[model samples]
Target chain A: MSEGFGLRSLHPSVLLLYYAGGITFGMLLFHPVLLLSGWAACLIVNGHLDGGREWRSWSLPMLGAFVALILVNPLISHRGRTVLYYMGDIPITLESVVYGATMASSLLGLLTLFVSYRILMTEHKFLFLFARFSPKAALLAMMAAGMVPRLRRRLKELMLVQKTRGIAVSEGTVTQRARNGARLVGALLSWSLEDALQTADSMQARGYGTGTRSSYPAFRFGPRDAWTAGGLFAAAGIAFTLWANGHGYLTIYPRLESFSLSKGDVGALAAYLVFLLMPLGWEWRDRTTWRSLNFGK
Target chain B: MNLLRRKINPKLLVIPIAIIYLVLAYVSLTRGNALLIGIVLVLLSMIPFVWRFERRQRQARELVLIAVMAAVATVSRIPFAALLPNFTPVTFIVILSGVVFGAEAGWMVGAVTGLVSNFFLGQGPWTPWQMFAWGMAGFTAGLFAHRNPSRRRRLPLLLFGAAWGYLYGWILNVTVALDVGVREQTWSSVLAVYSLGLPFETVHAAANVFFLVVFAPSWIKLLERYRRKYGALQRTDSGSADMEGSAHGQRTAAE
Candidate 1:
C-alpha cells in the first residue's frame, strides 16, 4: 500500500554513492562470515525501519525462504571433505551445509540492501543522476520503473471488472483457473495496447529520443556523502592492493577455511561499517529534529 | 474532405503479414541455413508496416497502444519462470493487442514485447527471433479486425494461433543452434532440441487458443460500444479528416 520508498527526497549524490558502495561490497568482501554478518545487520535494520504490519507480514516468508535455502542447498551440493552421513547416494557434509548457509545469507543480504535502496530512492532522482551520461536510456529506465505501479493498479482494476462480470477466477479448478488466467491475459493485453499508444504519443510529443534534453540539478554532495565516498574508495583500493599482493581469497568449496583477518581486512571492514552507518546518521538527524520540536513540552 | 470515400484499410494487412511471419519461421526451423536471413527480413518488414500505419492514423494513440502492449507483455513474461512452469502469457497478450488495437497496434506490440521481455530473460542473438515471432502473431491477429459473429469462427483461428506458437519455437531453436555453432545444423539436431520443447509449445498454443475464445468476443463488443457511444467510428473520408486534425494538433503542441 505504501508503494515503498520515495526516491525524490534523497540527494542524487547520496544515491550514487550508496549504489557504488553496494557494488564494491558485493564484489570485494564476499566472504561467508562477513556476508552473514552484513546480512544479519541489514535484516535487523530493515525490520526496524519497516514499521509494524509490513514487517509482520514479511517475517514468515523470510523465515521460510531462509529455512528452505539452508536445508535444500546442502542436499544438492555434497562435495565437502567433512562428510556427516550418507543418505543412499547423497552424502551430507558439514562443510556443504555451512557453505550453503553462507551463500543463502549473502543472497538475503543483497536482497535486503536492494529493497532498502528501492525504498530510499525515487525514479526522478535515479534518472537525474544517471541521465547526464545517457539521457535517452535513463529516461527509458525511469519510465520503466514508474510503469510498474501503474500496471499493478491497472491489473487490480481489471481483476475487479472481471469479478463483477461473474468471472470466478478464485473459485475455479486448475483447468478453469488456467482458462480464467488466459481470459485475464487477453483483457490485460487489450487495455495495455491502448495505454501504450497514448503513452508513446505523449513521450514522442515531448521530444523523447530527439537527442536534446534539459536537467534540473536537485542533488549535491554534502559533507556526509563526501566522507562516505572517500572512505569507501580508500578501503576498496587497499583491499584490492592486498589481494593483488597475495592476500588469501576465501574459498567455500571442499571445506571452509577461516582466513586470518590481516590489518588491511580490519581497515576495510571498518570503512564498510562507516559506509553502512551513513544512512543511520541521517535517521538520527531526523529523529533529533523531531525531538527538538517537542522542546516546549 | 469528402466524408464517404472508401480507402484501403491498413487493418486488413494483419492477416497476410502474419502468414508471411509464420512462413518465415516455419522455413527457418525446417532449414537452419536461412535463419539469419529470415530474422533480418522479418525485422526489416516491420519498418514498412509501422511506417504505413503511422502515416494513416493518429500516431499518438497508436504509439501509446504499442507502449502499453509492449510493457504489459514484458511484465507478464517476468513472473513466468518465477511463478509458473508452463506459463506463456505474453503470447496471449500479443494476440489481445491485435484484437483490441487493430493491425498496426498488434505489430508495434509484438516488436516492443520482444525487445522489452529480453531485458528480464537476458539478451542474446536469439532476441531478434523472439521479437519477430511475437510481433508477427499480434500483427496478424489485428488483420481480422471485424465485429461479425461469423468472424468468431473458432477452429481456423485456433489453428492459426497454434501454428504461430510452433513458428515462434521453431525460430528460437534456429537462433540457438546458430549461436552454439552447431556445424551440421541438420534436421535431426533441430528436431531433437525442438522435440524436447514440445510440451512448452503445446502449452503456448493451448494458452493462446483459450484466451482467444474467452475474451475476444467481449473485447470486440466493448470496442463497438465505445465507437457507437463516442461516434469515433467514422465514414472513411471523415476518419482521415479527423486523423489529420488530431495529428496537426499533436505536432503543434509538441513543437
Candidate 2:
C-alpha cells in the first residue's frame, strides 16, 4: 500500500482522468517521438512518486514486449516499400521498422502509465469512484478484496497442517502434488464457506442493509482538484483537437514520413505533456513544502 | 415524455450510442484499433447486466456469498501461483459457483474473481477480456446446470469445464489473432496465432477436466447445502423464474 502523497493525493476522479487521457492520447498519436515522449513523462512521474521503484520493477516485461513488438511487426506484415535488408527470403522494410518502433513506444507508454495508475488507484480509491454508480458491485469488490489476505493466510495454514497428513503439495510427483493441492483447496473451501456465512450473519445483525450505504472517507472535490481537472481537460482538448487535424500521427504505410515534428505536432506534444504532468504540480508543491518545513534557511 | 420514458428502458439507451461509436470507429480507425472495438463491445454487453444487478436489492448473505466465492477463487491462485502453468482451480471454482448460485451470482463471482485476482497478478489490457470470458463461463455453467442440478451429473460439468478451458484460451487469443488476420486478410495469419496457443489451450482444457472430474461433485454439494441453509438468493426456482418476487425473507426456491 503506497501512501497517497503528491500525485496519489489527488482526488480519484482526477487521477482517473489523468490515466484515461494518457492512454487515449498514447493510442491516438502513433508517432514515435510523441509516444516515446509520453513514456518518458510516465517514467518521470513514476520517479517523482516512488523514485522509479515500481516503474523499474515492471520495466523488464514491458520492455521485453516492447522490443518484441518492435521486432515482430516488420516480420509479420511485410507491406512497406523501403527494403532495409533480407533475412533468408524475408525483406525488412524501413516503413515496417518505423511502424514497429511506433507500436513499441505506444505499448511502452501505455504500460508505464498503468504502472503509475496501479500505484495511485488503490482499491479504496477505485471503489470511491465506482461506489455511487454501482454500489452493489463496489461493495462486493471491496469485500472480496478485503478477504483475499485472510483467505491466503488460511490457505497457508491449511497447507502446513495438511502436510502432516501426507498431503504435501510442494514435494511429490506432478500428479501427487496436483491431487494434494486439490485436497487442500477442498478443505479450505469447507472451512471458509462456514466461516464466511457466519460473518454474513454478523453483518445482518449489525444492520448491513438498513440504510443507504455511504462512501467511507468521502473525498471532497476541492478547489485545487477543480483547477487540476480544468487544466487537465484544457490541455487534453488541445492535444485531441490537434490530433483530430492529423498533426500528431506519423504515417508509415506504403510510404514513410520524416521523424521530425511539424509545427502543429510540436504544439500537440506540448499539450500532451502538460496534461500528463499536471499532477506533478502537486508533487512539486508537496516536495517544496516538506523541504521548507524540514530544512529551512 | 413520461410515457415515452417508461416505454423505452432508459438504462439500455447506451446500446445505440455504442453502435454509432463502433460504426464511426470502424470507419475512421485503422484495422488495428479492433482492440478498442472489442473493449467497447465487451463493456456494452456488460452494462445492462451490471445495471440490473445494481438496482436489484440483495440480501447480506447473498452478497457475502458472492464475495467469499470471488475471494476464494482469487486466493486459491496463491497456492498454485507457480504450479503447472495452466492448471489453476479458478475456472473450476467459477463454474461451480455458477452451477450452485445461478447465472447472475455466477457471473459476478467469475468477473470479480478475474478483477481481484488481477489486483495481485497485474492489471492490464487483458483484464476486461479475462473478466468477460470467466464470467461467461460461470453464466453458462448456471444455465447448463438447469433446474435441478444433480450430483450424479459429472459428465456434463466435466465437459463444460474442458470446453471452457479451450474457450477461455480462444477468448483471450481471438482479439490478437483477429488483429493479425484482419491486417493480412489471410486465414494463415489467424491460424498461426491460434496454433501458437495450442499447447497452452490443451493443458488448460485438460486441467479443467481433471479438476472437474475430481472436485466438481463435492463442491457442488457443499455450495448447494450452504444455499439451502442460508435461504438467500433463491429469487427463482428452475422453471418459474420469480426474479421480481416481493418476498425477500422467504425461502424462494421451491422444495
Candidate 3:
C-alpha cells in the first residue's frame, strides 16, 4: 500500500489542485499560528518524502536567509509603535520583526511545497495538464523539456571534443573563452537544426495534428481522487470563509496586534490544519496498511 | 462611430496596462495586503492573450520553427549554467526568435522556454513570473524587429537585451519584496530593496550586453536565413493576407 498509494498515485488534477490551494493560502494568509502550522506540515511531509535528510542541508541556508530577512525587515522598515532598539538614529520595532517571521514562514512553506511537488509531479503530469489546453504547445514544451538534458550532455561532449582539438572554452582569456563558447553554441545550433528538421519530417509522417488524437493516460481520475478533491474543496471553502470573516487575522503594522483565540479561530485553525495535513494523512494511512499487509503475508 | 468599434493598438496597450499594474501593486503595499494582486492580475490576463495568439492557423514549418527555437533556448541554459551564474543564452535565443519569426512566435518561444527550463531547474512561485518576463522581453523585441531588420542594425537589439536584464531583475525583486511585505510609503524601503539587488542587476546587465555583442549577429543571421529559405514554404500567401487584413481593419476603423 505504501509503495502503491501515495501522493503520486493521486490523479494529476487532484495533486495540482491541492498544491494550487495550499500555495495560495500559504502566500495570502499572514496569521502566525496558521502559517507556522502550514510550515510544519510542509516540513513533515517533505521529511516523509525524503527521509528528513534534506533538512540537514536545507537548515543552514534556510536559517541564514530566514534570519537575514527577519533582521533586515526591522532595520529598513521603521513601522509600528513599540520600539525595541535603536542603532545610530534608526529604530527597530517588534511589528517588523513579527512581519518578517510571517513572511519567512510563507516563503519557506512555499519552497517546501514546491520541493515536494517537484518530486511527486513528473514531467508527464505537467504536460498532461498543458496538453488539455493546447496539444501543439504541449508537444513543443515536451520537446523543449527533453532537449535540455540532451543538450547538456551534448555540450559536455562538445566541450571534450573541442578540448582535444585545442579550441576549448575553458583554456583561454575571458574574451577568447567567450568566443570559444559562441563557437560551440554555433556548432550545436546547426547540428540540432538538422536534427529538428528530421524530427519535423517524422512528425509529419506520423500524421500529427491531422485529426482527433487520443492519449495513453498513465493515471485515471478514480473514486479516491474524487473523494480527495471533494475533501480539499470543502476544507478550502471553510478556510476561505473563516479568512474572509477575519477569524485569525494578524496585523503587524503601525501597531502590533495581540494574538488572541476565539471559537471561530479554533474552527479556522482546525480547517487549515486538516487542509495542510491531507496529503500527509494519506501517506501515513498507506504506510500503516502496508505494514499490516506485509506482516500478514 | 461606436466607441467600442475603435481599433486599439495592441502594442501600445501592454505598456500602459503594465504601468497600471505596477502602480496598483505599489498601492497595495500600503494597504496592508501582502498579496501582489496587481501583478497576479497582469499575469492572468496575459494567459488568454497568449493562448489566443497561438490558436491560429499555422503551417507545419512555423510550428517546427517555434518548437526548435524553444528547444534551443531551453537547452542553451545548460552550458552557461556553470560558466556565468544566472546568465544564459535563453534571452539571446528568444530575442532572435522574435526578430526572425515576429511577435507572436517570440511570445510563444519566450513563454515556452521558461516553462520547459523550469522542469530541470525546479518550478516555484517564480516560474509564472519568469514566463511573463521572458515573454514580454520577446514581445518587445518583436515590436522592434520590423525597424531593425538585417544584422547591420544590431545596436538596438543589444540595448534591448541589456535593458531587459535589469527589467527582469527588477520584476523578480518585486516578487521578493512581496514576500518581505515592505509596504512603507516612503522611498527608503523601496530604495533598500533595489539597493540590495543592485549587484545582481549589474551582473545580469553586463552578461546580457556581453552575450548580445558576442553572439547576436551570428544567431540572428542563421535564423533569418532559415526563415527566408524554409519559413516561406507555406506562409508566402497567408502572411501577406494577414498583413492586408490588419491594414483593412485599421482603415475601416479610421473611416
Q: Which candidate gets the maximum DockQ versus the true structure?
A: 2
- Poorest lDDT segment (10 consecutive residues) of candidate 3 chain B: B232-241
Could you tell me which 10 consecutive residues in candidate 1 chain A have the lowest summed lDDT? A1-10
Chain A TM-score compared with the true chain A, each model in order: 0.75, 0.95, 0.92
TM-score of 2: 0.90
RMSD of 3: 7.2
Q: What are the lDDT figures for the candidates, one per model?
A: 0.55, 0.79, 0.71
Q: Would candidate 3 be rated incorrect, acceptable, medium or high by CAPRI criteria?
A: acceptable
**Which candidate ranks first by TM-score, i.e. highest?**
2
Better of 1 and 3 by DockQ: 3
Q: Given the true complex, what DockQ would model 3 score?
A: 0.28
Q: Which ten-residue region of model 1 chain B has the weakest summed lDDT?
A: B230-239
Tens digit of per-residue lDDT, candidate 3, span B1-255: 113312543334546746654564555455566566744664765666455644664555666667777777777765565576766667777777776666667877888888887887778777887788787777777766632345336577778888988888877767656544447766667777778877777777776778788777777778766765554332312213457466445433633
TM-score of each model, paired residue for residue: 0.56, 0.90, 0.87
- What candidate 2 gets wrong by more than 4 Å, as runs, is A1-4, A85-91, B1-32, B148-152, B236-254
Error of 3 at B200 (Å): 0.9
